[model samples]
Target: MTDDIRVLVIDDDFRVAGLHRDAVASVPGFTPLEAVHTLDAARQALRAHQPDLLLVDAYLPDGDGIRFVADTERDAFVLSAATDAVTVRRAINAGALAYLAKPFDAVALVDRLRRYARMRNLLGGDAALTQERIDRALSIMAGGAEPATVSRSATEQLILDGLGDDDEASAAEVAERVGISRATAQRHLAALATRGQVEVRLRYGTTGRPEHRYVRVGKR
Candidate 1:
């Protein structure tokens, strides 16, 4: 049998689901199955495809995505815009291997997938396990890393300054406030999040996908 890891992408947003499907397909030794939207579709896909890993979001039309992951008892990780402490804790409690916030760059996702693959191989190997091997595998699963510290450029600083103390704004709002394009604002915000200079939070509306908003660290 093939050793490729099968991944199922579940998101309410069609475009975001497609983006994740492409991301999963880009990784070596990983196969992307059909991208599904609602929780009902996800359930059908799970029963039909039995994917090895799930790339799921928190908000869905039918129900909570993380709870679905818990109920299925599958090997999965959350790729979502839900950054609230309660949501994060619930995912962890429900046995999600990782909870990646939205707006992450493609490189970050690739690296996480690679590390997960490595961890999977180590755990699935037939060889006898040792302390060192087990420790290494667990470390990969933990995925702990110190936040990066980097110098900001002029444009980045302008974007940062646009936000008032204790205020949160989406990339578009930041862009308008800073007189830059939304794409430029998003890029700088992602960089700032990586550098631990800002925090990205998700705000769900009455309908549609959640909005990713950024705030200065220690402000929230």
Candidate 2:
């Protein structure tokens, strides 16, 4: 086990992967090995790099992120736009040290990574478990005591700003564009969908089923 934690990011979106790579690199005592777009590439990178941490996307073009965790014996985290309870539980079962719904703030991500680093350092043959330490770790990874403070008005503006030239976008796409967590983006999008401000549709792909996609309503 290396003292300097190495990270590998697995995400299909080049931009999102880049953002995460930068986020990890900006943290002290952490180094990013590489960011890959598919599970196959991720596995190959793991074989070659033997990374200390894996930041995996929930959905990938080649396979599910859970499969990667099952196949690898390394510490991992699930970074995804899907925050459904089922997905969260699956990630936990898959042995992820943490589950971060995208688009997580840079600071928030750094905080989680720092906690992981601390945990790794503190682990020893006789390290005793204490409630305080456990609580602190959980709090750090779960965004601490601060509730998500993004305003509905700000969310609407973010959605609008993320609109593409084609006038439509998926919830995940918009979340990435707006730099807010996917869960937050979906909440705002749900409100817009209900009010006829945006249209919601199923996005079918190779990820096993169709996912909800949101677009500005009445766009030409």
Candidate 3:
């Protein structure tokens, strides 16, 4: 892995900031910087560290954290107890990569961090972006709602069933196993992957080309 993605957490609550910092450090690819309790301190840390990402709360002692994200124009995601529509809209318009409501479980925060890591993994090159690549990155950033919140079709369920635990197979292989066309298999796999129900790994062969292989990840 390359240098860990450095993170700065900003919140007015000292305990919450510490919790968030610890959580960020627990993730595989992330390194949490010292957490800041005010937008003023956050600004100083930003200048000093220029971290790859920021985890910001909506309210800060000095100013609005979402506004701070906008002012910094850095890669930021919001974790706040603020549930107002206007605040959400501000986050959306401010270009927050993702947002999580406060009082969330550790698993939920871990899921978001992992999803962000996956997006960075996918779009990690300087080459020109293709539509497919852009779409895949966007899907990942969307951080699909949990399975219980998303209704799945019968075919999608069948596709999920085709991949056994510890199995990683290409869409074409899954198509063959599920008696579906490769295109259909690819489409459904992409959807499942976006929803965090499956993980995508790139298999490089002797030909030097990479093939995407999917592994079951989330619940049924």
Candidate 4:
């Protein structure tokens, strides 16, 4: 990749397109070249700007986003809420580098984009396509490991890291530090508990039934 990697955001929802555009702009070595809400507009933008990367939605007003990826020269990734396995497989078949679910945090977007930038840089200008290169790209897209070895999401990782120092933290406290909801914090905590990473204790309150508090298993 060059010093500045240009990205085009294509989504039917203008708000979502803007969000993705802003996310790409916030990443280092990246520039948001255009935000288009339809496949037709995306094609026009692609012809005009020739971006280094394309972030396209699975659903578009004009046509299937996968078609755009199939026809475009730029590296593409799908950002959508659609979880159907068939759709995801089609996207992979269409040459999307990554398939990110919707409502992902900006940090996750940056991570994916940075990975793509690294892959592009490694290939260099005029680099020949090889089996090794294809394997590396697939590995990156598959989260760099087999399913069993893959780590948790960024939000989950943050929660785990935060729990590293403190043996215990309330859901409210975790939410405040992680910038998520208390319910979301609790759900993650429960998942960690299930995995034996932490232990939970119920603290009874005078005015209510009880509240759950979590503590790292080995820490305390």
Which digits, one per residue and each the tens of the lDDT, describe model 4 over residues 1-220?
Answer: 1258889999888887888899998977789986988888877887798888899998887788887788775689899899899989989899998999888998888878867764554355474644544454456555564223323464476566556656578988676444445787788888989999878988888887788888878776
The candidate that achieves the highest TM-score relative to the unseen native structure: 3
Location of the lowest summed lDDT over 10 successive residues in candidate 3:
143-152
For model 1, what is the alpha-carbon lDDT of residue 202? 100
- Residue-level lDDT of model 3, residues 99-195, one tens digit each, is 8999888778777787787567546658675454455457657864222322347557667756763368899767644444589789999998898
How do the predictions measure up, each by TM-score? 0.63, 0.58, 0.66, 0.60
* Candidate 1 lDDT score relative to the true structure: 0.79
Q: What's the CA error at residue 106 for candidate 2, in Å?
A: 1.2
Query: What C-alpha RMSD separates each model from the true structure?
Result: 17.4, 17.3, 10.9, 12.2
Model 2 RMSD in Å is 17.3
For model 1, the stretches where C-alpha displacement exceeds 4 angstroms are 125-128, 144-220
Candidate 4 TM-score over all chains jointly: 0.60
In model 3, state the lDDT of residue 40.
Answer: 86
C-alpha lDDT score of every prediction, in listed order:
0.79, 0.75, 0.79, 0.75
lDDT of 2 by residue, 33-113 (tens): 879999989988988989989999989998898878867978898899998999999999888988888877988788778
What number of backbone clashes does candidate 1 have, counting pairs of residues 3 or more apart or in separate chains? 0
Task: Rank all candidate structures by their TM-score, best first, as comma-separated numbers.
Answer: 3, 1, 4, 2
Q: lDDT at 114 for candidate 3? A: 74
